[model samples]
Target: MNFQKPKVKAPSYELIHKTKNIIDKYSVNTICIESACPNISECFSRNSATFLILGDICTRKCKFCNVKHGKPNIVDSSEPKRVANAINELGLKYVVITSVDRDDLSDYGVSQYVKVTKEIKKINKNIKIELLTPDFHAKKELMDKIINSNPYKLSHNIETVESLYKNIMPGCSYKRSLKVLEYYAKTGILTKSSIMVGLGEKKEELIKTFYDLFNCGVKQISIGQYLSPSFKHHLVIKYYNKKEFDELKEIALDIGFDSVQSGILVRSSYYADKM
Candidate 1:
């Protein structure tokens, strides 16, 4: 069978230019840019982005991610300050912070996430901060540290259904990721999670996954189609259309999710303020 590349709509020139100017001027990095998210222009056009803290290089090579992998450079202590500065410059009322898995670090880069959140809050006490963090290998101390940071919302993407975890995420565990989200959900702050479809997940399995998250106390969710970063990465098994995504969203809402975003371009941080 021939592979049909999914169509990706072009981003607006004004949005690309404006987002580029901010990125260049502040020397800040966004997951939207680094991950090559399909919704970059939409998010950037709204003057919003998920800031990539800690650095661009990831320790884990998730098959779906475009971010570079390998030995990451030293953690730049100034990164938090710069990120805060960028948010201020953009005059953003809401901000999201996410980072690469720093498996080599003793704290698993948990402290950096906390520091960045603190610095951003310090800049403007009213700014709503959301964190999309790694699972921290499910380390108790690290999870506790993240909870202490008290971001407006806490999220850790399950990434894919449990059945596909082993094949797609070599170093991650579905159980551990759930525990991380469950832990944060128990904190009284809004807890969120995300999953990508079209990597060969079944409708029944996807419905079961939604129940698992709802049962774990997660209140917000994002569901989107998986676009393989490159041919070297995992192949997209299928591209779900709008109708299918809408059905998934309805299932999620019916499953007791307080808010849900499900569409081809929906991402963990896309239109996050609405959730």
Candidate 2:
């Protein structure tokens, strides 16, 4: 289709360096760096970040993800304290916590999520915490732990349309992801999910996916252009322009999404506090 890559503002080197310094000081990971998020500069400059807990290495090999995939390190028992300290040092009132899939662990890393959320709250009860998590195969026992932790919002990115699951998200089930969101939503917790466009998905397929999520009680959704991490990863089939993203947002809202963020750079945790 001969689509050109979208341009983003140049990152602020000073602020970015400052944010990195704090993160380095605490020895924690962030999806911003691990996933190569285009909005890292903006988020870091604002002194906000989506903390990547449970380590940087993932057990699953999702082709569209930039996070490292392989045997991960042993879970650090003291990570929760460090993460809480980092958030406090950043002076952030809202924090987003996500993790690499820890399928290697029997609990699929749910304990880390719970512990991190609790630790963040312990530091400051007023700080609002949001979690973007792996499916954990939708196990109620595991899901209950996160729910009981009382995060302000819960999110799990669907990532792509169901039809593209086989190629873009190996070992990940679209239905299972939906169930995870539904489980959280049913608890009256604000629930959200994200989708990447330009992965060779059709318009109708995208619409159907939106309806499926809304029906499952996902209240917030973000749609963005999928930039291939590298030539070896999934290829970007097309880039939706501003008009197309606007239309998608309108459609999702019409279908009852309480909030929608759609653009080339929009991501699951981008400007999450504002949402």
Candidate 3:
């Protein structure tokens, strides 16, 4: 009997005990676990993790994302306390908070983001908060308020090349995302963004995207492979080898990015503490 063809993707890793304990104690949600990110164990074992705020359900159904897509729960007003408690309990000096696109509420669920950051800061004066926010509907003033709150290292992932934006990240606009990065950089924030490979993006297109990001004043960048988390998402076009990833890094640095993380399993928050 013939078996169905096997799909190629990174194998999953075991859980990191310490990180599990922290999550259990404070009830924090992580993108690594919800998204099934392959780098979960390594990052968690090192006590480096990215928090997924606004609950696990996502309002927007992006094909590339692994988070649950459905109508989300009502706003948990006390979530900020729990998030702060988790951060304090983990003793994380550096922390990242990302949320699903919650167009369900007015302000696009930004007030919660602001409240969470403010609460976390109140807990630790010196904690570094990095917010990977949604587009804020591309309104400059809203984006301005979001930035004026002053989180360290503002990042909004562009997610993929321009050609695939329509099909892959429909809720996002390539130009709008670059503008978000540029807006933060212009305001004296250390701005950053990320892009994914293995989405049918050509090398030439990747180079052009790099230049576009540099022109937008992005200082840090992350490049990684796009492995499908489920059968519903777009098929992986190709996975770049380790050498290819290094070559991409060399080109990004040569193009004026201060820091660039390029690897097969790299995610927006992978090894984020070193940045």
Candidate 4:
């Protein structure tokens, strides 16, 4: 069955331009632009963005991701301060920081997250900072460093159901992703995860994935329709409708997720502050 794509309101051109200028001034990266996020205009118009630290290049070639994969650039020691400056100039009260999968690094780029969080806090102690991170192979010592940074929330997306892992997220482990979230949750951190639908997953499989996340202590979750980035990327096997998104949200809530955002245009960090 074919489903119509939902409509999104146009973003303000003036606001978007202003936001882009600031981003350019700092010479920083954003997942919004790097991944070609559908909500880029809206987010930019609001002067909000999820900072993409480290560099734009990723180490893993996840079939569903749009972030470029290959050997990444060396860690930019100045990136943390620049990102913090960008947030300060934007006058943001809340910020989300994420990075490309830098599996090439010794600590898997964990120190960068800590540095960015601390730098942001240094500028505005009250500002809430959320870190959407790579799994870091679910290492406790590495995770402990991020936990000590005291971010407002820590997120590691499960991305898709277990049955689809091998094909969709090669070199990533479903069980290890759960262990990442579980570790943060056990430490009393506000841990979160996200899932993408329309990858030919069975409804039962999604529910099972939701339970797996909840059992491992994910308090927040987002479910969104999968749109193929290019002809070369994973094909979108389905386009979930409004009713289906609502059903998923209801199921997630019933399963004890404190917060749930499920819809056609939802992304892990889309409207993250509000979520």
Candidate 5:
């Protein structure tokens, strides 16, 4: 395949104004809003969204994400209750909570992650909790705390193929991420991860990633298109069409993923009910 700029589709999704209003009122951050995710409408309209807790600002800057970076805002003690309340009010059954990278904190914000998940469980123990976490650079102690919290599933994204890690996510190492996922898998947790196409990944490399992750014992995978959030961010290299995504989903299933959510508009947490 020739390397050329991919064509971005016109944004066609719609959001329920009330959903935005409530989130704004609660001061919650979300990938849907913060990242301009294409599936925001469909996800939010269905009362599904990944809650961005702690604060909106990230300490590390990733080339393909839209979450604001620099000095992170203060960690709000009130934030956990607010997020849980919003989940209760919105009547969400499966809630995914993520956040801006907060490496400045000594514990890498594990305290806040624990509090948020604990509060959500208090509101509804049956609520499926999925966490998309920072690399933590494979800190065993931090990983222990997060896993001990008993999330329904744990996800640390290997966002691109191994070769492209540094250029795409400067603060994260591909090995560190895989190690995080590997720890969860070995501990009998339902481990999950995500990746994006259109970031100059080759077909064989993506296939290799599936087997690599499977060898780590992960059971869930999410594949989505990589659209640059802005010109300053990473540029899109190729946009695999719907048929290509379908082929990948089949390949992933064949490679041993118990579940696969792969599509043009798919995000790590979009239509997450599949897993």
Candidate 6:
């Protein structure tokens, strides 16, 4: 539980403050701030953020996640417009929209995603959207809603290897996550998923996971080191160095992923538009 922090440069307080002001002014939540992302300074400096919609409270208590787990607030009807407006104000040609797991909702928050994607497209036809969504419990109707929205890319993070799902992600199902990616892939829209390393998973296990995703028709993937958010969260079993990340990226590309982003600080939404 006492792992050393990575040797990254200090964040720019001025830029961080500006980013916080923009998020507050628009009354929006961003994963950048909420997750205490290591890339916050860089992403905020560039005026880019992954909007966290459908409230910050999550239904599932994943051991490695920083998102709060408990009963969530009532759905906010005005969130979509706020997201679109914030994206417009930031002049972002490419934006990422994500949300907490709203299992309380019948659609698992799919309607919110559809609305936000539609609003963003309506406001700026040329802007590209990448949605990092929850599994929707692999419901066909909910998945259909997301595909119908026609985001440039639809992504759901696998979070960790299959063998560790029960303990690390609890209520989540590894196979169901794959099915979600497969379903999205069948729609012909770009489909993506992400995973975290250093969770006591072996290299062979990681390779197998890559093959599983590639066979499921996932086009893009992100692999990153898993840093425990707090002492109460899952401990980091190990830290893969930069070279290891590079090797994993190569392995993933060979497995037929069209694009791969792998690094120590590469979260699912990190530099998402670059792909």
Clashes per model (N, Cα, C within 3 A): 0, 0, 0, 0, 0, 0
Extract clashing residue pairs from model 2.
none
Residues 1-275 of candidate 6 have per-residue lDDT tens digits of 43455665666788768777878988999988778788888888878899999999889999988888899999999999998988888889999999999989988889999999998988999999998988899989889888988889888888889999989988899999999999999988898899999989999999999999999889999999998889999988999887888999999988889999999899898888887
TM-score of predicted structure 5:
0.93
RMSD of each: 2.0, 1.1, 3.9, 0.8, 3.0, 1.8
Q: Model 5: runs farther than 4 Å from truth? A: 1-15
Q: Compose the digit string of candidate 1's lDDT tens values, residues 5-85.
A: 456566678876876787778787889889999877667778888899888999997888999899998999988888998
For model 1 the TM-score comes to 0.95
Give the runs in model 2 whose Cα sits over 4 Å from its true position.
2-4
Candidate lDDT values, in order = 0.89, 0.93, 0.85, 0.93, 0.86, 0.89
Cα lDDT, model 2, residue 23: 99
| Model 6 score (lDDT) | 0.89
TM agreement with the true structure for every prediction: 0.95, 0.97, 0.92, 0.98, 0.93, 0.96
Clashing pairs in 6: none
Q: By lDDT, is 2 or 6 better?
A: 2
Residue-level lDDT of model 5, residues 60-158, one tens digit each, is: 878888989899877899999999888887888898898888999998888899999999999999999988888776899999999999998898888
Candidate 3 segments whose C-alpha is farther than 4 A from its true place: 1-15
Q: In candidate 2, what are the lDDT values of residues 1-275, reduced to their tens digit?
A: 65666776777889889889999999999999999998888889899899999899999988889999999999999999999999998899999999999989999999999999888888999999999999999999999999999999999999999988987788899999999999999999999999999989999999999999999999999999998889989888898988999999999999999999999899999999999
**Candidate 2 weakest ten by summed lDDT:** 1-10
* Cα lDDT tens digits for candidate 4, 76-139: 9999999999999999988989999989999999999999898998999999998999999989
For lDDT, candidate 4 versus 5, the one ahead is 4
Give the winner by TM-score. 4
